[model samples]
Target: MNAWSGRQAPSLEDFEEMALAALEGLPAPFRDLAREVTCVVADFAEDEVLEEMQMDSPFELMGLFVGIGMAHDGAAPVTGQMPNQVFLYRRPILDYWAENEDTLSDVITHVLIHEIGHHFGFSDDDMEAIEADAETEH
Candidate 1:
């Protein structure tokens, strides 16, 4: 008998659950700063997004940050501007999880923060520091 006979790959809904849980676990300060940022989970990156980002495959992109970041705003949102968004690519994240030793939650949290880091125009070093700080709180 297969030990995982009834198991199936995590659905988009499952990924959404993970994404929300990851977001909820973030430090209050960081979460507050990203309060307005919307996050969505999809099986793959949209074709246009992949093309724009110059990726050969959707699996190459784990997540994406879209819309104007706070760091770029000289003023508040314009009348018709869309809210900032983070797109988490499920298939790619699953693939990445499969190939790495890290736990699934860690992967999700990393991707979430990395995208948010881009929104805040954080450097790699800054992100690392933030990640380290967040870890200490957990």
Candidate 2:
């Protein structure tokens, strides 16, 4: 039998689980900052979101960070402001994975951490270090 046996695409819930696992593997500091952020997994970007981002196709976006970052002013909670959220687009990520050299879990972790890095106003170097640390932990 071929190694690529019958395998179904991960469901939304599966994606969510993978995202959460990525969060759990983060360094302590990043994990603490991410505690208040919600991770949402969707098959693709919503049409409204696509319009707002000026994206012609959902595949153009793999993830998005919504809300103020810690480095910004007035990041504290307001009386009625919605909580911070990180959105992971499953279909696009899967498509990318299908065409890339990375494993599905690696792809999921990269997207999750990249979005969470935005939440912390982290630089690319900072995110890369965090990802490296996460890899060691696993």
Highest TM-score scorer: 1
For each candidate in turn, give its C-alpha RMSD to the true structure in angstroms. 1.5, 1.5
lDDT of 1 by residue, 1-138 (tens): 898998888888988998898887888888888888899999898898889889998899999899888789833776799988999999999899999998788888889999998888888888787777666766
lDDT of 2: 0.88
TM-score of 2: 0.92
lDDT of 2 by residue, 1-138 (tens): 876687788999988898888888888988987898899999998999999999989999999999877777445776787888999999999999999998888888888889989988888998899888888888
lDDT of 2 at 51: 99
lDDT on C-alpha atoms for all candidate structures: 0.86, 0.88
Residue 135 in candidate 1, Cα distance off native in Å: 3.0
The TM-score between candidate 1 and the true structure equals 0.92
